[model samples]
Target: MLPRSWVAGARRPGPTPPAARRSRLYAHLFLWVMQSWLAMFYIGAGYAKLTQKHDLLALMMTWPAQVDTELLRVIGGIETALALFIVAPLMSWSLFRSVMLVGAAGLLADAGGMVVFHTLNGDIFLAAVNCVLLLMSLIILLGRWEWRDHAQLRNATS
Candidate 1:
């Protein structure tokens, strides 16, 4: 949601322009909303994978049969960790943003793997879902990096 100046990697030695400030505000608001949805979705899915023994089988049925419960739990752990990173922004802003960048990258990779696996398993619908998640992860990763770089530059120049 950044204006042309900020998105273009603009750097100057003074207070941010009012327009740019507004742009930054909008960007943050948008990210907060999207991240909240992602965090909530993963929280539930992770919990199910980790603890819901009865439903785990049905929910994970799409996965290849070779993936045992232990491996499913491991996947759940990874999902939980990534979810925490996305939601960290709600706790400590500085730490959350930094950790989220890393988490989003991990999620991106995971989604890619899911896509490949789903496709190989003859499930285009599942692969499509993973593809959507992959795009979302990518947006978070790129957006976080762009904002981080811009803020660091702004702080340095100021």
Candidate 2:
């Protein structure tokens, strides 16, 4: 047997008490808001990549002649697809995880490429931004389990 205070602290509440329930509701709402923000960011990024015809491609073409246009196009297409996958409502948790993993990898690669470009061309600001975005993507990918739980809770509430 334990002391009365210890027992009281250890006791498990049935389901959730009213106050606890309200807190959980608020937490769920916050999670939904975060999810919406993430989804919208991905959607906007994909849109920008798809719509903008930037000089990045031209710059790439000038590099090591072995780099092909087809490869660049394929990378752009993959990024857009992954962004769409992140925002898709019907995607499974496993699929979302896979997409996040791939996106993180891509972001890391982009960061490396940006660093190299900046080192060669002396563009510190762009390289720093790319590094920051890479870190954000890695953090999101690592915390995917929490996002999965949030998604599950949201689905249950709906």
In order, the Cα lDDT scores of the candidates are: 0.80, 0.57
lDDT of 2 by residue, 1-158 (tens): 87766664456546767898898688656544544454455455545445544556455334323345555455556656655554443366555656655655565565567567755766677668656655655554554446677787999899
Q: Give a tens-digit lDDT track for model 1, residues 1-158.
A: 87767666556669879999999899878877777777777777777788877354666665624577788888888988998898787778776778888788888998899999999989999899889888888877777676667898999999
Q: Give me the runs in candidate 2 sitting further than 4 Å from their true place.
A: 1-72, 88-90, 145-158
Candidate 1, residue 66: how far the Cα is off, in Å = 3.3
Q: What RMSD, rounded to one decimal, does every model reach?
A: 7.7, 8.6
**Best TM-score goes to which candidate?**
1
Model 1's C-alpha root-mean-square deviation from the true structure amounts to 7.7
Number of clashes found in candidate 1? 0
Report lDDT (Cα) of residue 144, candidate 1. 68
